[model samples]
Target: MSETILPELPQELWRAGKLELAHGVQQFLQVMRVASAGLGQYLAEIESRGVKDLYGYGTTISWFADIAGLSMGEARPYVNRAIDLNPTRALDGTEIPPFAPATGAAAAEGAIGAERIKQILEILRQIPAEVSVEDREHAEAKLAGLARDAGPRQVSDLGEQVLGWLDPDGKEPKDPEPAQPRRELTLQRRKDGYWNLKGLLDDEAGARTAAALEAYAKPRPVDEFGQADLRTKAERQGDAWVDLVDLAIACPDQPGTNGYRTLVHVTIGLEELKTGLGTACLDFVGTMTAREARLAACDCLMLPVVLNAAGEPLDVGRLRRFVTPGQRRALNIRDRGCTFPGCHRRPKNCHAHHIHHWADGGPTDLRNLTLLCSFHHRLIHHGDWQVRMAADGLPEFIPPQYLDPLQRTRRNTLI
Candidate 1:
């Protein structure tokens, strides 16, 4: 590659008027679109040169994902587009043409965007296999031309009409054996410590899974303070899945491991466990913040193994912070639900939070304890919000100064 000179950005953008700003936006978008087309060309060349031979990677998609700091799911589309819109060379050094050369030309000129390019390629792929090569080329040309002045939806509508014209009568129906139900699931961990879950389920299993998740995914009703649930549909569904997993784990009939119930172990140094100021290792998965470990330890969700400076387990007395079954029952009766003001989450979905954090020399007794749902628990721990047990023996929240200048104490009235 050679060094290339480019135009400088116009100065004092804040001084630009509305029309100038709009014109600048249009020009920059066209530049970006053309640059993206160039990137696709480079990607195709890399694929042709053999990503494994050049970069020592198993696949082009994984290599790009690593280089760009993106998940494989996010990088696959770019690789797929590059292969479709750029020509490739066969093993024998024979030059093969692009699947959608016309669309590629339009994209290179920045006349169409990613969405229209995708639409045009899909339209070309749907052309009848028996159609003459000349007819297929004509169809691609027409779709690319339609795409220059229209959005993806308009291009797709025209594509449907073109397909109908090519095959006025659809393929003849032939009787075949009834298909068997099939399902496959893939769970992979990403570099960011998050897991990606992708799956395919047959109709019956899909319907049942949808019904179960939907039952728990309903939006929380507006509480007494009129603050409605702000979680998006996808967020609600993700939380619902967590709820289902917890329910399954809580079942007594679940299989055990080595004569003990399947348990998650959190390993933390004594100082980190006491001060909540460092990281802790989680069993099977990865690490979590000491603050998160402290919170989980309060409810005994994960058995905490306190270690000394030499990295040996210490006798930290696990029962000291563990809330007994009777204590939990008493807590359920006392709080009825999350103690955070305006929250309507039930006891079953709440965690036992130590108002004066147990890690800070606070006793694990009723007076120092409160029930908080996961959202509010994180808010209390990570945000400016504060919770304390009032003189009346019930939990009360003190609003942060920014939320209320006077920092008024509020109590949940729904209980």
Candidate 2:
């Protein structure tokens, strides 16, 4: 390992690092960029050749992506660029500015020297064990500037200088920015047969949603709570719905395009899960009647109410469903929204999914559904993933048969 350079302290006596430092940092950066570009180039070449093979003539783009760790969307473009840059055989049998046009490698072509593309690879072989992939690329981009001046001797010196600065013993990085917001919940069943729950949202939604749930869950006083009548299930539910609507309107929502809020989901238990071996199914709250329940059992993420052997309400807490306002809120929340995983769907990009579908016995409760950008929902409905409520009354997923024989399950605990 070499040494780290300190910015000149005018009063301090000069050290010998001055010459070695700048040149070293510069050298390491250049060598790495060439290599990464080369890998990209190599993959491109293989794909071009592979696609034309008779046995794979009609191979789907996705099939190629699965092998390359790229999304089909990305693989297609990468392949195109590689074919255009085709840099495999220079007279000296090395890369000849293969990606110059697309990547500005021409100006850099002359900037790097001595380390011929072939020589650069040899130097890269001696790259320090601790030199990271990023370091390699950063050095490579800078090295592009050296395309006309550097030689193997400089690469060795550069390695020492870089390893000194990057992995300077015990000089760890500052805390990094959090990738996703912190959100989580715990649902525990008490001996009393009721669930005690707690959750955390990014900001006020956490408190607001919790308070709203608490209000609905509060014990009633001789049926004096709001406009509900326990004697009639419809009246009681109607009252509950009014409370839900009132809460949705008054709560702070980031608004949506269609004059409403984003949809919320309240996934209840599912029937297929209860069966264990058949296809998955869901039941939305708006149609929780037997007929609706029966139909919803055909889709994914729709929550079917769970009943005991004697068929009594289990107090498993209802899910929020989307009403028009909720939909507005949903659209607002997901302005550039699609709920399909990794989808970038906007308002024009989605369909409001019934956490419980209308065909199934689901309610129009905000907790009963979630908004899914179309592609993902279709994937859910027709692909390998099966989403349903778990024993805990939240959404869980079972991967399709094609993904694994072990049946890996996933959970989307965010409500």
Candidate 3:
């Protein structure tokens, strides 16, 4: 190869007029196109002579990266261009044609750059293999002519139009294969005492799970204390999953429950059960705070095994702490839905919450119970809201001190 000299820029070019500066930029781009074509040809020569083996590199790209200080990503396009534009010699010494001869010629003369050549190659490659050699050559020549006057983006759009004209119906569609069964679940305990759940489900099971979660994941209403449901979408979905578990445990037809609706057993000391400040064993797998045990025990979703200080089982309370079905039907009919001031839940979604807790000797009758959804039920237990039965045998809510200094009573009329 002969060494080429670069032309010196005029000293006044820095302060040149707008037209002069624009013309200088166009000349620089033309020089860059010629350099790019030379680089591609050199790469082709290096590959033909197996120069990569002398350098102890596996491929031409690795060798180019080390020699030119370019990353593999930057060197790959040059190598690809070389493979498309350079002719090869067969074993018998006959010359084989390059993939894109017209593009190669234009690039060598500084008439087009790598991007334009790449766009032309992409369009030509998309021609169906079933297409004849004559038809493919015709399409390639037409695209290369368009490239001379149009940008890569315009050329790409024109290629799509040409392909549509060539094959109006597009490629033939194949029949879909049968779906395989797929269902998996992983429940692993973490060091922090929380269970990590992961799973995959088939289409039918996924759709059913999504529908179930969405049915219970509706946004919660603002409470009597003027506090809105600020939980995020993921948080609401998690709460919905808990509600679904509760529903499944309460189902009468589920197998392996031994005619008992509860799924697990929670054992706690009598002092802990009363004070709600200690730890309790949960199904021999982990421990939960006594307060959570109390809440779980409230609905009797898990059977509670009360132990005295001596670690012997003791009768904590009546076996029937949960409201009876007959009593629940009466409560549902009376409250209609959640009795929170702005809640809109239906009767089926409501729980029979105790005005006075059953553990505190409150009766499981109509006068001591009102229906509340899961969110409002927790709010009543944890937030600064209050609930009571009025003289008309209906439930009403009272605002917290921060929200209503006067603490006026309110009722939900939306339900």
lDDT, candidate 2, 1-415, per-residue tens: 1132333333543553676667655655554444444545565555544554623545435555777798878667545444434544433545544433322352233243222444444434445567776776566555444535566566556655645565567334476764466788897866554456576788766676556555554433331113232335444444444446533433455243233333322233344333332332222322223333332333222223454445454434443233565445654363334443333334432445555555446765444555554345655655666666556544455665665577666643222
lDDT scores for all predictions?
Answer: 0.81, 0.46, 0.78
Clashes of each: 0, 66, 0
- Greater TM-score among 2 and 3 belongs to 3
Q: Against the hidden true structure, what lDDT does model 2 obtain?
A: 0.46
- The parts of candidate 3 lying over 4 Å away from their true place are 1-54, 59-128, 131-177, 201-218, 221-226, 247-252, 257-262, 315-320, 325-330
> Model 1, stretches more than 4 Å misplaced?
1-181, 218-231, 257-262, 316-320
Which candidate, 1 or 3, has the higher TM-score?
Answer: 3
Candidate 1, poorest ten consecutive residues by summed lDDT: 254-263
Clashes of 1: 0
Candidate 3, residue 242: Cα displacement in angstroms equals: 2.7
Q: Stretches of candidate 2 above 4 Å error?
A: 1-322, 327-348, 390-394, 411-415
TM-score, candidate 2, is 0.22
Residue-level lDDT for 368 in candidate 3: 86
